[model samples]
Target: MPDLRFQSQPPAHTEIPRPKRAEGQWSLGYTEPLNKNEQSKKDDDALNVRDRILYTYSKRGFASIDPADLRGRFRWMGLYTQRAPGFDGGKTAMLEEEELDDEYFMLRVRSDGRLLSHEAVRALGTIGVDFARDTADVTDRENIQYHWIRIEDVPEIWERLDAAGLSSLEACGDSPRPFLGSPVAGVAKDEIIDGTPALEEIFDRFIGDPAFSNFPRKFKTALTGHPSHDVSPETNDVSFVGTVHPEHGPGFDCWVGGGLSTNPRLAEKMGVWIPLDEVADVWSAVASVFRDYGYRRLRSRARLKFLVADWGIEKFREVVEKEYLGRELVSCDSPPSPTGHRDHIGVHEQKDGKFYVGVAPVAGRVSGSLLVELADTIEEYGVAGARLTPYQKIVLVGVDADRVEDLVTRLDEIGLSARPSQWRRNTMACTGIEFCKLAIVDTKERARDLVTELEKRFPDLDTPITVNVNGCPNACARTQIADIGLKGQLVMHEGEQVEGFQVHLGGATGLQANFGRKLRAHKVTSAGLDDYITAVVGNYLVDRQDAESFATWVARAEEELLRGEKALTPS
Candidate 1:
């Protein structure tokens, strides 16, 4: 018999307290053991990507770009291998790394809170037309993703975006990504305070700075003074939610360690009230804590959430205050509870008496041509500007009441709808096997098809339900918080590998924040999704009591009834 003693029972001598890790300490092992010749490049690998960009990529262009720099370093500058144009539905799952990669690139433009000047929006539209094959997407992060970029055109793209006062720098890196904010941060009628200045100040100071360029893993930040907590503060690593400080008047309440993905966690309140002026510095301090002490040994456990989880909120706060902030934060009131819907859809009145029309672009999909037309229409209507929402929607701000009708008409003409059906309005999908490498199935078009049919079937239905679809388990579309969440996977169907999804029900945000519970043994094949959803939703319609939300109904309903055994087809 093999001596199978568990590793948990370590030798007595090895049971000492582990040495404290140095600041900014991390160790990432190579994917494969290296030979003598390859081992020499270890030093080069140790250097940050900033060196490679200046010395290698800038000088060599695409032809002479190093392999490590191509796949890994480029992301530090917001570049990724996009699916080539005219790539039909082939190789849905990237079993082999090379199977999904391409020479073309996808460029992400960071737009914090969808804040952009009219000129910037127009410039983005033009860039999409000229470079991205007319394809553009308004991401859930309030950023824009453009596909079909070539490495050769990078410098020019940077120049054009720079002229618009926009940047792709550190957009998709291990460093802190773009700060998410409420679309109507400064102008919303119910806002606690204008947080635009704090967001802008943080962006101006830290973004692209070498001091904070490297991190154990990606860091996410969100700041919003909106009373509705419009940025989904509970789902980010660092968030400053709006709250009234009784004695101090308007200030922000802090939340930390919130994240989604393989493991989802709602943020914990830090019990500290941050004054408006000190928010930026506090934000920096939080980020500095992540940079200095965040786990670096294993990428899987490197997120700040893990650290926060291990240390608990109390110790984490102690470390942040002692090691980073060097001052005790003021204890303040809790964050304001979300009031009503924060989706920000439909035409609404702004604080300034001007009308703001919010429109959904069908799962965040929009073409360059549509963007151009929208820009022209906004200019024609004399609207102040536009803002992107975290809900994968856009809001046209500063529209006069007289011009609202014209703008709505123009928006409808461009295929953007202010009055979208509930199915269309609530449906969201991630970049699936269509472009994402980790995806196991299609999402965008599939979601669009599902929404189209659902709307047609129940045209007059008025129940509020969010249906989120993801390409994989990463939860980029926030599948966990949806009424009906579909996580993509591959299964054997009629002797062939076909797309399928595991369903989760009853997840929601706001006061009733909770992750959806996964259905027991209910996997719906892609071909049968339409019928499955219809049956479940139809069942909800029949059984639900007076004005009961879908999430509430699913939560109370029995698992067997919710599953609808007759509706789901076997994979």
Candidate 2:
């Protein structure tokens, strides 16, 4: 395949149109068609007739060829360019074709905004690309992903994605990516106001901005006006959390250094309280500071957390204050309120007379078909759009009171019904070794199996238990803050090597955030992992104090006690 250099294009400045019926609300649209000459040029640039044919078939599905013929065509495209169908044999070899690993491909999709689209999925199916829906898990950040996309599909996938309102702007290569917001940001009854508008504005500005598109390192930002810690602002590079200050008015309290990549660190407060009116400027200033001072020499040490650690919190704040305020920093007029709960699941009434439904996904995994179904469902039953929560759940906002029952029934039919007693509701996992090479175990599969078993053992368990599993120490599942956190590892049992996990307990996500401490290490085959987890939970339930969260219980448990509980024989 020829290395084509598509010229970098600047974002076109266009006025966002207001919906005819709403006052401060605007509707998002992507009606602009690509120029014919440009499309023709793109088609012509695709290698040969075979490449063009496969590209067309991928977009539409089903090629006019047998399996043998398809294999021959793929071989001709070369191993580097071919998209192999599964997790068996030479997977890395196939990944080598596009200069990216399968895990990076999934990350690219989430970062690029092209992961869950009808055309993108169809294209994968066309080329005999057996991408895994299970492998392409959702992040706690509310981004959907697909793993193992072929090199040939990249261009067409990107083009179709542009037409679908998904942009590849800063999805990868060290830049500020999607602006994270609460899945229920605008619709929650307790929300001071929806932060989506501001979030969308920030996204629009940073995604294509030359200054922000290629920063020194990856930058993450999240916003939420809701008091709940659902968005997990303490774990981002730059977080704008909603708070009410008498002098600053209703706005965000900014924090920096929180991230979960290589060197995990909680973000520290940088700005005391930034007023709503100054959010854009404050955010822009923080980005500028990161771009200018953030280390670029080493990938592992490139995050803003490293910068904060190197300079200390005070110095980091000094830099941001000097740059943002153009003078000395001032003390905060008011302290932030305590961090709230982590229950984004279950049914909840919105400030509007209608209700918002939060459905727990076994893992944060959604297919293109699911997305289409969700879109259709929202159009049919919802007054507004569907919002995604960081918990890998979907919130159907503004459903009519009369149709809530019908909506619930339809959701169940689609295999997305919310359950009050399911253990899977509180379980979260990151994409593991099946998709990401960085992962040491199959976190998603393990998490699902564990939840299923826990439900069977403790059928009526009502206490909200957060069990997070990460394939590696990267903590993409936010395991550090989970009540029961599991980081992937390989363990030896009776001189035989097997996949196992190290457990951490007592982690909490709040004002006094604390990373969980390592507990007992457990070794079990993938099939029996669940029974072991259930036993551990059973011990916690019996020993915990009234109203104590699982994390709190784990924190108070003695090491010997935890070890004994983990070593219990599975019933």
Candidate 3:
């Protein structure tokens, strides 16, 4: 009884497992998704891991956890089993990712750079203390990270987080990540417009939505109306930097495709001025373009940056406006050169005439107990709010003017100093080999030691230079954009293999935004890191122009000076 249409099964092509292309040509089949991870996402939505964790993994021990879910789906719930102990740096590439999995996990709680209530801060502190082995670090992306998490405790951790109005969902993985905004979002005095409403709307309506759950790679966003550029707009996938149209008062400028891993690229502007009400829509449209059109064949080229690079800004914007947004965006002028501080690392006045004290933790490392103490101080002082900055610093907003001095003194006693030295102020380090499987060298402790050495050797060397240390080439510490970016690896120093770094010089953001330039054949042994930096920085102090920034001086410095050839323990 069925009417059968004349459909013929096409004969199977006898091609091998190669892509449907001849050498370089990309055919329709070649453009199709081929990556195993892409297939995994299609087979099962990563969000389903929440239920699995609640009903299964939480009850079963680590041995009972499924291998696929352990390595892939667990990320959707903000869980990553840390690098197993006893694995040396040399084994980094030799073993599979699963082979490096540890019995413990690292859990990241998303804050999205929004102001957290004192109660919420205390709850997070408690979670860190009780569930995460007293480990907590405020990451550059504005997430609070905890280590030593066990699979059995995830359900309890989720319960504690839910009670505090926090969740780790979509915090990591190939999905929309926590939104990054100005730490001083609604409280800053000079902000032209607050961006929290936009972030809030996006988070509520879209972050966990299945439509965006299958991106080829993770999406990072930054939004802020503050002139300070405190959110690091230069290195995000989708950034809304505050700007104003000549005719239209104040709004934001949309920049797409900025990211900072192996293939470093600064975001390019779409030349459009977005009204406050339209920001969430514009952001969604941009995300849609990435979801539907991004490359999925190679994990290496999956970032939105690669798509934007291939299409160019004009075409990328055209596709969004035409296929996604059904309207035109108001044209805007070029972004103004940044004038305010990037780190926001000192006491500053709020619009309410209140003070917000920025406290620096040594390379963003802090204890769970110390965090609880911070919450106590905030409550004690009746501070208006608390936030984590993009530079891995903390700011207590709305500190009473009269109590500012006492607050600073108390913070110092707790080790979150209001006034940190130059070495501490400018250095940033990633979760190196101690915790991260991808890292090959030390970062946190090494950076701390480097700080001490630099302070002792060049306490009076006053040029502002940033030293970013990463365990490997992933650039998680934003190493590519630092004045002295160090990518860790093993190298032969003085004819013996040792842990060391590949140097990247002169990178910066804001007015002079650019990735650091590489020095060919330049690798410094870990033992020689301090000496190398001292030699290079010391040279800059003597040879630099009167007001030259460290990045500026490095741009003009000779190769010999940058390599610190004379100071290095030669290979």
How does each model score on TM-score? Answer: 0.90, 0.76, 0.93
Which has the better lDDT: candidate 1, or candidate 2?
Answer: 1
- Cα deviation of 468 in candidate 3 (Å)? 0.6
- State the TM-score for model 2: 0.76
lDDT of 2: 0.59
**Angstrom error at residue 170, model 3:** 0.7
When sorted by TM-score, best at the front, the candidate numbers are 3, 1, 2
TM-score of model 3 vs. true structure = 0.93
The best candidate by TM-score is 3
Off by over 4 Å in 3: 1-33, 339-341, 566-571
Candidate 1: where is the Cα deviation over 4 Å? 1-61, 83-96, 339-341, 566-571
| lDDT tens readout by residue for model 2, 79-107 | 11122235432233244433322312342
Model 1, TM vs. native? 0.90
> Scored by CA lDDT, what does every candidate get?
0.78, 0.59, 0.84
RMSD of each: 7.2, 11.6, 5.9
lDDT value for candidate 3? 0.84
Clashing pairs in 2: 58-123, 80-97, 111-171, 138-364, 183-388, 258-267
